[model samples]
Target: MGKKKHEPPPPTGGLDQNGLEKRLCNCICLCQLVSILSGVALLYLSVIVVSPSKQTLDAEFESTPVVCTTLENMRNSTNCSVLSCGEWCISKGGSTCAIIHAKVRREGSAVSFRDCDPVRATFCSAQEYNQTQQFICSEGEDKTGQCDALDRFMDCKPIKNKADDIKTEMTSLCRNITAIRDCRGTKPDGTQEKEIHVCTRYTCNALNGIYECSTGNCKKLENPTCVDRCSNLDMGNMAVVTPDLFHWGRCRSAFSNGTRIWTDQQKPLSMYCTRIRNVSATEMEAEDCLNGTLMDAPSFRQITNYKQMLGVLERNEEPLFEDQSFLPSEKTVEIFNRTKVMINVLGCVNTLRKECTTWLAHKGRDGSEGMHPAVYPCFITPHATNYVITDYDRQATVSQLVMASAVPSCLLLFSCFCLCLCGKTVGVNEFGLFFCKPCHKQDGDGGKEPAKLRAP
Candidate 1:
């Protein structure tokens, strides 16, 4: 009987399957809601992290730059809670920050804080960087007092090995004039036969018969019957003449008149002076001739001029001449050391050259207004936006004077800027609007209204 009763374990005690499913779904719904809320919170945090607030500092100070202060001073700052509105010019690396009263009026530039030595800041120009590099690498120009020696001999090309014909002909001419009867009758012994030397060191060859000679030294004739031609005019101080001088005469076949001879019917017979030693001669002396020296050029005088030019350029000194390439002199160095204000002015000039070269390649080759940008990578100061456009226009003024020949259009743009700054009609707005200011006075009186514009 007990086994039969166990038949269907009285169907599982009444269970609420729907209610269990409903409970599970409710739990899932709660988890989804939590997940959605979490996502929304995360989105809110992300937005807060990325978007920075636009705020302005409003502290006022004199035109001097505010340098780093001590910790005590910073703690004592009353306005520490608010961002300072003064000019904050950060260095290129964003490491150093200085609050300058003067604003940076250019884009892509930062206030330079790297300490520059007096000498380096004097003649600093971007174009001269390579020159400066070379100057640094080298010890300096050779200033030693040594005479610059030069060659004293002519650079004469020697006769080729096949000049045997010229040699033979010259020897024959010498031999032909070896002996001569006293034709001048300088020696008188009444009728006795007087033997006189026709030419000294007489040499003979088949090409030319006898070359005349008088003593150990052979004298050249004005018109010789021999094949070789020699000069009748005396070559004074022949002992002083170098062998090269004679070689040159031979190469050119110089005649008695110092001109070369040429003829269609005759071969070129070059008469060159040959130095021969005569063993039989009792009297023989050695002599030397002088040569020319190289003359110094006029350009050597420029060294002195450059020194003077450099002196004038120092101390914002008005230059005497514009064309001269200037160098820094002791005076310039003195001025640089004495005045920081002047150095700042020159710094602007150096900055001009440094930034302009970057855009030179992109500008028009013709003399148009286009030029390399005269701005550099710089941080934005509080007053940067306020003065950028206006200062750019002012910079054009100086640019016009210096670079008029290079870029005329840029000069014109600069001129327009100067005109606008001086013109009464132009008015500046906080958000950078350039337009003619409205008349606040009667037609006769100048616009007397103050330019104090309200921030929009």
Candidate 2:
């Protein structure tokens, strides 16, 4: 007989097609749940965890304390830090009071009382205690005699003559030589020591009886000889030197009734003028003018009656200098023009000593004609009138708008994509339950055959 063929083992725990389908359905549902949970976690990290961490960092930065050590640093510190340091200094009296006293001696009345607070008077009085130290450290000590001689030189006014300019030059040279000799101390061999002198420039207006000099290398005058008179004889009507465009010489024009009026040769005009008039008990109208039109208005006043209007000069009891004729020499005019062009090019408006706005109003029958606009409609408007958006505000608004729209939309799209990929379902019943029932197949011996699974 032939060897019996090995019979194939029957499949264990056989499942039908329906059971395979149910298993596949369960697997898909599990995968979908996992994907949804993963998406939610991603969203939490993106929106809640990461974003809140940045916010927390910003909050920490804002809450951080400002630290200042030295007095100079304390002075330049933030308001909160300054207050804290001041309080600390106040509590730590003795040494801090000495320090405050030193500062008061150096800065004089310019020192801020806020830093010393309740002890300002004590700090000020400390100067008396330290007077000997001030004298010991003074720059004026070694040069006292020379400075007095220089002061005498400044006082001596020679008789006005043809050789006066030459005499003045010699006097300046002698004073400068004396200043340099005095600033340098004598060595062991009687030779002058080579030490640098630190000099500060000050306007004549700032100078009082005694020249307040800072302690450094040594003290020296910028101009060794003071100006007893104007240097140039050509400076006619301009007795006082002024840093301005139309300074007692250069002509300025104004508009009246659609006509440009030039000032007299003796008196220079102002560029702009302001006039005020009473409209009611509670209200008044003001008008301002440039060379041509009223600055506040779009249209020019074609029909202005100067006679009917009472000028500000009449209301105020200020006297108008009617007898004076302010005629400047040709040299003075040239200097004024040159200085004006230079300052204008450099944009040094703050340095101008006499601006057109500073001109006083004068209305008289005779010689005060070109002083300032009298009955002219001139108004003083507020410097800044329009609303403006700053760079910081604009940037903040843009950032807020972008965050409001972009963040939510991005999260929503990510969630939808995750659901589409992992949670696709095909069959469902009327009761909203997923249909996946197992079905069995009969074999020739009345036994069930294993079901082959299909991918969903």
Candidate 3:
């Protein structure tokens, strides 16, 4: 019976093989579908899923670009500007990623960003400020905590009409003006440089070509509308005209040496030295008394701070005019005669008439002489009051005469106009108007030459 049962099982072996083949095919299809579904899930997550904390911010600025992985890092990054994180993404490998991007547009030497989270401000190069080099942006600090707290500061303020608020805003803006009072830069030499912020509209002045600090405003440095008489170098707030000063120095030297005489128009005429005194002996003594006496006597030499010296003159109590006398009265007489002769020779009669008529209209003859008013004796001009002749030469040499007459012909009218100005007492005749004289009365004869008339 056991032999017969085994024989029946052997007969069904072919069906068992067919059943095994069907099961193998179903397993391969299931594996393929599972692989495709896994890929689909990954792609879906890539498009929508993102981490909240991990972010990157990018800014294109003149200074430096910034990239940060989180908003907290962004706030700490020195190169970060006025921006915040907006969106983020997670990588397929489950890596968290964040990004922020911004661009700055400005044309200036330096630009500063305000309201930035981590990196607050950056400076740019300008024509004047930091002339030596441009500032570069660099890493600043670490901001780890307070990530959610910063969002509270991000709400945009509603725009409002600013015409009236502008006035108040101006005051509010300037409220911090004096708050940064200790902004002065220190030099290596232990001196402090003046501190001024050049970024403002109220203080800007076009008269200044560059930015400067006004009392409370930023002002522009102005170019000279008139001639530029000085350099950009600082003279401690008092500008010095070098060329003008140099010319004055030359004139002063010539004047003191008694070897040069210049016209009112700065024309060198003749070399003549005439002795000058300090008004009176007692005048010098009074000066000596007020200033507690001098180391030496007061001479014709120019004094430093003459205005201060004049103040001393006002308070002087001692007699300074006593015993004061003119040197060589005969020389004075000869000069007077020569002047009279020149008047007659030059035929200034008509000019004199016009000037006298004008003068009488302006200043009536109460005690003043009409045609020839005496202002310190030697001065003879229409507006010669308070004027004095500093020097006089008997005869000018030919060389001196040429130099005196060599001024540009174009300036003749300008010189005349300047003389007619209110503060000017010297007239055109002093610089012009040649005198023709009788042969005996000419400069070469009988006139005693002063020291100033000597050749240099």
Which candidate should be chosen as best, given TM-score against the real structure? 2
Model 3 per-residue lDDT tens digits across residues 1-456: 133221111111222233333443344345445445544543443233211001100111112211111001122334322212211222121211211221111111111111112211111111121121111011112322111111100111112223331232211111111111113233566554344433222211111122223433332222312211111111110100110021011111112123221112322111111111222211110000111111122321232332223333333322222221211111222212211101111111222234423322322211111111111212232232211121122223223333333332223434434424412321112323222222122223245332232233
Measured by lDDT, the strongest candidate is: 2
lDDT of 1 by residue, 311-341 (tens): 2223323221223122112232121111011
lDDT of 2: 0.24
Candidate 3: Cα lDDT at 392: 25
The 0-to-1 C-alpha lDDT of every candidate, in the order given, reads 0.22, 0.24, 0.21
Better of 1 and 3 by TM-score: 1
The sequence of per-residue lDDT tens digits that candidate 2 reaches over residues 1-456 is 554454332322233235565675676666566656655655554443345334323322212111111111121223331121111122332111111000000000000001111110000010111111111111232333122222211111112222222222211111122111122233467654343333221111112121223332232233232321111222111111111111112112322333433222323222211332222332222232222111111111221222111121123222112221121121221211110000011111221243312221111111111112122111111221111101112234346445644565465566556546434533344445343322322231346443444444
Question: Candidate 2 vs candidate 3: which has greater TM-score?
Answer: 2
Prediction-by-prediction clash tally: 31, 7, 26
